[model samples]
Target: MKHLYTILFLLTGLLSATVSQTRPDKINVILMGSTHFGQEGFYKQGPSMDLFSPGRQKEIADINKQLAQYRPDMILIEREPSEQHTVDSLYNLYTSGKLQFAQLSYGRAEQYQFGYTLAKQLNLPQVYGVDFYSSLPTRLMRDGKNLDKFIEDLNKFSNLGRSFDQQLKDGQLSLKQYLLKLNAPETLQATYYNIYINPARVTDGSFGKADKTVDTARIDKSHIGAEYISLFYNRELKIYSNLLSLQQAHQSKRILLIMGQRHAAVLSKILEDNPDFNLVPLSSYLK
Candidate 1:
C-alpha cells in the first residue's frame, strides 16, 4: 500500500507539470488600425494623407506621444515576413541616425510613421513584419445575376470610407481625431462588415477562375461569397499564425500591431477569440 501511494503521487506531479508546460502564457496585444499615409499609388488604393505637412507632423507627434503609454515590448507591422531583413536594416539605420524621414521614398507609410517611430521612442531593438498576402479573386462571377443593387450599396459604403479619409486630408479632422474615430467600436464593426460580410453576400459564388473556362460541374453555387472571401480569411489566418510564431520565438509580453484600419478591425476579432492573447483596446491608449 505504501509503495502504490508513492507512485500515484509522483504520477500526479508529472501530469500537473506537463499540463502547465503545454499552455502558453497570455500575451497582451494592441491592434492599432491606421490610415495609409504614403503616396496614393504605393501599397493600395486609398487616401494618401501627407505626413510631412507641418500640421500633420505635429498631429503624428502627438499621436506617438499618446501611444507611448502602452510600452509594448514588440511592435509588428503590415509588411510581409519576407521583408523582415529590409525592416531590420531600415530600423537599424533609424536607430543609429543613419536614416532620416527625408531620405525615404515611402517614409509616409504607417510602417515608418507609426511602427518605426514608436519602436525608436521606446528604444526597442527592431520592429517585426508579420503580414501575409494572397491575391484576391481576379474576377467575380455573377452568372447572369444582376449585382447592380449590391454594387450600389457597396459603393455607398466605400464612399463613406473615402469621405472619412477626405476629412483628414482636408484638415477638417486632425490625425488623432481621425484615428480615434476609426478605432471606435462602431467603426470597426462597420469595417468588418464592409470587408467581409457585405462582399460574402454575393450569391453568384463565382470568383477566381483561372481562365474563362467555366465548368458547370465544379460550380459552388451556395458558397460563392464564402469561397471568394476565403482568400482574405486565409491571409488573416497566416498573419495570425505569424504573430504566434513571433511570440513563441521572442516570448514578448506585450505586442503592438500597426496596419491598415481594415486589417486591424478584422484582426481584433480574431484576437478576441484567441485564448492565448488578451486584446487590449486601442482606444484605451489613444485617448
Candidate 2:
C-alpha cells in the first residue's frame, strides 16, 4: 500500500505539469496601414502630411506611443524575408540608442518613421519582413480596347483616397482616427469591393480565354479580368505565408502588423478566416 500511494502521487504531479504546458490562447493581431515616406506612390501624389515637419513628426511620435501599449510579442512589416538580415542590422542600431532610423529596407519608408519608433518604444524584437512581389499577368490598361475606360474606372475608385484626405483636412479625424478607420471592418470591405473585386468586372476582353472557370459568361472568348485579380490575391497569399511561418517559429501570442492601407483589407480577410488568430480591431488600441 505504501508503494501504491507513492506511485499515485507521482502520477498526479505529472498530470499537473502537463496541464501547465498546454498551448497558449489565440494570438491577438492588430493589422495597421501606413502611408509611405516618399509619398510618391500615394495616388500618384505625395502624402498629405509633411513627414519632416516638426508638427507632423510630433503627431507620429504620439501615435507610436499609443500603439506600444499593445505589448506585441512580434511585429511584422511589408518587406521580403530575404531582407531579414538588413532589418535586424538596422533595428539593432535603434535599440542600442545609437540612431533614430535605419537606411536599409524599402516600401513607403515606414521603417524610419513608423516602425522604428514602435519597435524602440516597445522594446520588441526586430520587425519581420512579409512582403511578396510579382508582376501582374494582365494590365488594366491595354494598348487600345478598354484602356481609356480603365483609367476612368480607376480614377473613380481613387476618389476614395481623395475623400479620406479631405476628412483629414476638415479636422474631423485625427491621425490616429484616420489610421484606425483604414482597417475598420466595413472600410476594408468597401475598399476591396470597390478597388479590386469591382474593377475586376471590367472584362479585359478575355473572360473565356483567361478565366479559370468555364461558364456561359466566358463561353465567348474575352479578356477576363480574373487573371489580374488572381495576381493581386496570389501576392497577398505569399506574404501571409511568410507571416504564418514567423508566427509558428516564434510561437507568437500576439502580432502587430503594419503594411500599406491597400493591403489591410485583403490581409484582414485572410486572417479573419484563420481560427488561430483573434483579429483585434484597431479601435482597441487606437482609442
Candidate 3:
C-alpha cells in the first residue's frame, strides 16, 4: 500500500509538471511603433506628420481598421508608469463619455489616436501605461570640440530620419517597405546607433584602450558610451518589466503595445525573449 501511494505521488508530480508546461499562459503580443504628432516643441523640431489633417486621419482610421482584427484584450500606451492612475481616470472618463478624446493633451498621439480608439472599438476594460522615464547624464570624457561635433552629428541623424520619412510620404516606398528598411541592421546603425550611440563612445574617451579607429561601433563596458547605452536599454527593460507585471493577470490574452518607432527594435527583442509570450509580427497587421 505504501508503494502504491508513492507511485501515485510520483504520477501526480509528473502530471503537475506537464500541466505547468502546457498551460495556455502564452500571451500574444503585438507591438506597434508610431511617430508622435502635435509635439513639435518637445522634439525641438517640426512634426513628423499631421495626424489631425483629414487625409492623415482617414489613413489612421484605415490603419486602425486593420489593427482591430487582432481584437487585443488590452492596449498599452506610451505613458509613464507612474502616471497609471491618471491614465486610468482618463480612460474611465473617455469610456463614460465624460471627456472628449480631443481634449486630451498627454499622449494624444498614442493614447487618443491608437490606444483609446482601439480600446473603445474592442470594448476593453482598461489601457496600460508601460513607459519608464529615466535621464542618465552623458558627458564627453575628453574635453575638446567633441561636444559640438556630437550635437552636430545628432542633428544630422535627425535630418536623415526626416528625409527617410519624406521619401515614404512622397510614395517612394510603401509603409511596410519603409518599416522593413528602417528595422534592418544597416538602417538602424545608420539612423540610431551611429548618431545617438557611436558618437558618444568616440568622443567620451571611454572608447577603452582599444583601437578607437575601429569602424564598427559597439558598446563596451565601463565607459561614458556604455553609460548612455545602458540607460537607453534600461528604459526598455523597465517597459518590458511593466508589461510582464500585467501579464499573469491577463494571460492567454492578446495585447497591443504602442510606442515610439525608435524603441520598437529593443522592445521587440525584449518581448521575444520571454518563453511564454509570442511576439506577433507587425507585418501581419500592417497588411
Candidate 4:
C-alpha cells in the first residue's frame, strides 16, 4: 500500500508538469508590409504628395488606431540590428517629447511614420530594428554577357500593382486603401514571386566562359541569377534570426513588424511555416 501511494503521487506530479508545459497559445506576429512613405530607396518614384500633409497624416493615424487594437508587445522595424542603440535613443527622445517629428532625417520613412507613432500611442518601451542588409553580386548579370536576356528576365517580373501606385499618385486611392491593396494576400504572393522568385529563373551562367571580363571567382558559371538572389535570401534569413532572438529575450507573445512590402511578403511565408509563431494576417487587425 505504501509503494502504491508513492507511485500515484509520482503519476499526479507528472500529469501536473505536462499540463504546465502545454502551451495553449502561440506567439502572434503581424508582418506588415509597407511602402516607404519617405519615397526613398527603390521607391524613389513613390507618390508625389507629402506624408506629413494633413490628409496623409490623418490616414496614417487611423491605421495606427486600428493596429493598436492588437496591443502588440513589441514593434519591429526595417532598420539594421546594429542600429538598435540609435533606434532606442531616438525613440526615447520622441517619447519624452524632445524629438519633433520634423526633426528626424528619416522622419518621413515608415519606421517613423507608422512604427514610432504606434509605439508612442501604445506607450511601449521602444521599437526594434531587425533588418539585415547585404549587397548582391549584380555585376555578374551586368557583365555584358547576355545582359539583354538578364534585362528581359527582370522586366518579366514587373510590378503587378503599378496601377495602384498610379492611383495613389493621382489621388484616387487613399493611403489606407492603397496599403490594404498592398497587403492583400494576392498582392503579397505576387510580390514574393516578382521580387524573390523571378530572379532565380535567371539561371543561365554560360556567359562566364565567353566574357573574359567576368570574375570567375565570384560568379556562378551556371546559376548566375540564382547566385545573385542568394544575397537577398541570406539577408531575410538573418532578419528572421534576429526576430527569434528578440522573441526569446523579451518573451513577447505579440509582435508587430514593419518592413518593406517585399520583405513582408517573404517573411510572411516564413513565419507561416514556423510552428512557434502564429502569423496573424494584417486583414484581421488593419481592417
Give Cα-based local distance difference scores for all models. 0.77, 0.68, 0.66, 0.77
* lDDT by residue for model 1 (1-287), tens: 99999999999999876543222366888888887777655324433367776766877888889888878899999889899999999999999999997698788888898899999999999899999865454245454244455566657766877787778766687778788888888888987876677666667555444433334466576766665556567678899999999988999978999988878878999988988777877776776
| TM-score list, all predictions | 0.81, 0.75, 0.70, 0.80
Model 2 clash pairs? Answer: 36-108, 37-108, 205-222, 205-223, 206-222, 206-223, 206-224, 207-222, 207-223, 207-224
> lDDT of candidate 1?
0.77
After superposition, candidate 4 runs with Cα above 4 Å error: 1-24, 40-48, 136-140, 143-153, 156-161, 206-216
lDDT of 2 by residue, 1-287 (tens): 99999999999999866433232577778888765654544423434444554655777888777777778778888779999998888788767877553243342266567776787777776788888865443343343345456656567656766677667655666667777776677778876875567545555354323334333253322444554566578788988899899998999887888888777888888987998877777676676
Stronger candidate by TM-score (2 vs 4) = 4
> CA lDDT of 201 in candidate 1?
61
Question: What lDDT tens digits, residue by residue, belong to model 4 across residues 1-287?
Answer: 99999999999999866433332388888888987777554235543456877778888899999999889989999989899999999999999989987786567888998899999999999899999865443334544345566566445534455677777878888888888888999888877775577656665553333233334577674676676566567778899999999999999988999998878888988887898878777777776
Total residue pair clashes for candidate 2: 10
Candidate 2 lDDT? 0.68
Lowest lDDT block of 10, candidate 2:
207-216
Better of 3 and 4 by TM-score: 4
- Residues 89-186, model 3: lDDT tens digits: 98889889898755756444756877887788888888988887654333323333255666566677678767767776666754455555655555
Q: Tell me the lDDT of model 2 at 137.
A: 31
Scored against the true structure, residue 157 in model 2 reaches a CA lDDT of 55
